[model samples]
Target chain A: MLPMSDLGRALCIITGASRGFGRTIAKEFSRVVRPGSAFVLVARSGGDLRSLQAELTETEAGRAGLQIRCVEADLGLAEGLERVTKAAQEVATDLTEHVLLVNNAGSLGDISRFTKSFTDMTEVNSYLSVNVSSFLCLTAQILQAFPQRPGLRRTVINISSLCAVKPFSSWVLYCSGKAARDMVFRVLAAEEPDLRVLNYAPGPLDTDMQLEARSKSGDVQLRKSFSEMFSQGQLLSCEESCVKLMKLLMEDSFTSGAHVDFYDI
Target chain B: MLPMSDLGRALCIITGASRGFGRTIAKEFSRVVRPGSAFVLVARSGGDLRSLQAELTETEAGRAGLQIRCVEADLGLAEGLERVTKAAQEVATDLTEHVLLVNNAGSLGDISRFTKSFTDMTEVNSYLSVNVSSFLCLTAQILQAFPQRPGLRRTVINISSLCAVKPFSSWVLYCSGKAARDMVFRVLAAEEPDLRVLNYAPGPLDTDMQLEARSKSGDVQLRKSFSEMFSQGQLLSCEESCVKLMKLLMEDSFTSGAHVDFYDI
Candidate 1:
């Protein structure tokens, strides 16, 4: 993914900025957007977001149009959303025009049940609240916060998963959470046809989350299979995935109605 | 559909029994399921449930082994879930072994966008609460409730729509709600391999809901298209779809994992 920003002077608020793909997207934003551009980094860990803020702020390319601010919030609760909202409001100058909402924070629930196990319940609730409810609220608030700015475009990129379309065994909560999240975007798009909403299915990526998933799976055979898959280089790099996402963000031909695959676009 | 005692002596719970598919399913259960068997009917309206209960209990087949119990409660909130849980506890009898949970209640949110309208918020929040959260809680509770009495076979039939797989243009809330519900069942199947879960896409059905949807779509061209589709026999009768569903329930070879299409099975 080349570093170029056509989204000039736009304020981008990315959740899950502490690590994984969100971090990569934020970095890309820093590289592409011009100097004096503002970014609001949201995550559960304040220290991690602050570190990334400092890192992005220190780069020569980052200094071009980048101003970083970090906000710590669970992003899964109402209070968390309020905090993010408050921070976005406080840094009002960066958010004058279009708002880019990237709902990237999510969890893969305990993958071991047809029955409702305790682990499954907690994981399912947390995932739904974080991945679906949080996205819905944040998107609604942003739309309300910044009504359509003339000559400026607003877009929502919901970082969905390939598991949404594929029936991967043991990824029940994760899969459903994603599917639900996709539906939210679909519904929102249908309601506001003009809104640029993308349910971005980025496929698989070689990330720490996958490693953590493989380890916590508990099933030895399943862990071995995942390890084999990961080792076979079937996963996308964070940069590769982010590049595709950036391309989609730049493309004007695609509308806000479909579940788009990164490779297809 | 022909009214057979396929369920025999098993216990079943059907929500949204005040009217529509919920009422039909409860009646069908009463017609089948041998004498002395339990069928707990849940709905929001008590008067309607009492009348339905009287009709079911009066049947000769009902006299054999069918014990119809009506529990009035809205399956749309935490209080509703608590009500249903209490009802489930009450319905548990010495003969109650296995349980078949049918999560069939559905709603169509405000058909019009009506931006900033209270209707939209009510429709969105209510639909989310009922069509997703309540159903999920129901699945969770039933799964947890059935673990007792070992060797008890449990089945969760999530009645989905064709729109779940194929995106619809205007029925934003209805289509997305069903889509999310279907994904919940998929997640359940993935999480619990032992449970028999089916996301039964009942295709387009000639139900009141469909008629209401066709009328309130606010597009003349779309209504005509929908009518043409139905007239062309694209829609199936409830009896036919229900029979297909019952067949899936009775069949032993249809292994469960994720979403199972009625057409495919």
Candidate 2:
């Protein structure tokens, strides 16, 4: 089991760190890791990453000597993946006792249509290129960047969803992407018994994604439910979900590669 | 439930139908369907497709009045998918009472390496293009081509594996692809209640895939197990596994979108 205190000296890399849950995690996770910890924040938006970098540097962990690197690149593209992996490698220092990578980058594909409407090969391929293929390859690249060594604990967190286990109508791309990612990391856990992998499904959070779901989902009933959840204040805040995730991480008792939901913890 | 004796007057399309389990399915299914039934066999190997077409043409169903069209194309490429869907659209005649689409085309991606070794985006994208993306898009296209209508039962059979539910060491691409495809079809079952979707895991079969697994799989234990299965003749022949699948279809008692294994039946 992990020690009774906050995580010490972790080399944390969070994708999609510019906005939403990724940004919230960056701020909240900073408060947990000790001084001398490093963060590699990656996203496509340069301005947002810069602002996040500034906000993180002013925090307690940052003032105590946290090193923050903002990587403005698309996690979906090969070149963008190269930049992030290279940044993480460069930031992996001798003080890095634990490695925690948050694979949070994803897109809710055109939910305005049903499964049968996704006939164009280019459209489908582009979706998988971003969500499935890139996610798998990026995790592989990051793990490669930080090889296993004595006293160096490695943990991979996938910001997964309920869709990973449940099938949602008109959510073919997002659900399949989540499902594939969960299985990919499960394979990672099976192969590397020493590594810790968690597929954390942050509950339906009140975020831009939820708004998109409410407005654009193809199934009218599903769309209305999202709107109702918002109106009823049933949606979780990013911090609310992240707190549960933090508790799970501190407990460190989850079966490696388990699909743990916010409510499950 | 589907009729007990035989499936009559259907437009049957099978991918990867040139050899292995797919070929067995084509031949076995030919025996069960009535006259005026059409068969669309798709494979990258034109010669193999031609030979299978010829073989299928000599069968009793063929002799009676079965129409066979060979699509020499790769399921991985857009052009190949276009060709198959076009051919299926052309073959959906007035006599076509039922449409059965067998999504059997897939590749066992580079299994000689671990998850951490698959860092190249191109390699990963190419693998997904064939296994994951193409499978989803093709299904959507076929469904679009043959819209749901009165008296026209639509059946989609995904040649899934235990890997769909169980992750294997170093079999990242194949396992995840299967998982994603199963979930994709599950969504299809949810969205289209009238459509029949079955994910059939054919156990371990004595086919070219097994040979490849025994020779090329990275994990020593996994490779040895495959070898042991082969040496002990524990692997089911293609015909044997297909017989179980045939039984499942003929009975048609399975819940739509269920992952029914050969042993389960």
Q: Pick the candidate with the highest lDDT.
A: 2
Candidate 2 residue-wise lDDT, B1-265, digit = tens = 6446777688999999988999999999999898889989999888998998888788898889788999999888888999998998887788788899999988899999999998888888888889988898899989989898887888999999999999999999999999999999999899999998999999999999999999999999999999999999999999999888878877888999888998898
Per-candidate TM-scores read 0.82, 0.98
What is the clash count of model 1? 14
* lDDT of every predicted structure (CA atoms): 0.70, 0.90
TM-score of chain B of 1: 0.87
For candidate 2, the TM-score of chain A alone relative to the native chain A:
0.98
In candidate 2, which residue ranges exceed 4 Å CA deviation? Answer: none
CAPRI band for model 2 = high
Instruction: Determine which window of 10 residues in candidate 2 chain B has minimal summed lDDT.
Output: B1-10
State the lDDT at A84 in candidate 2: 86
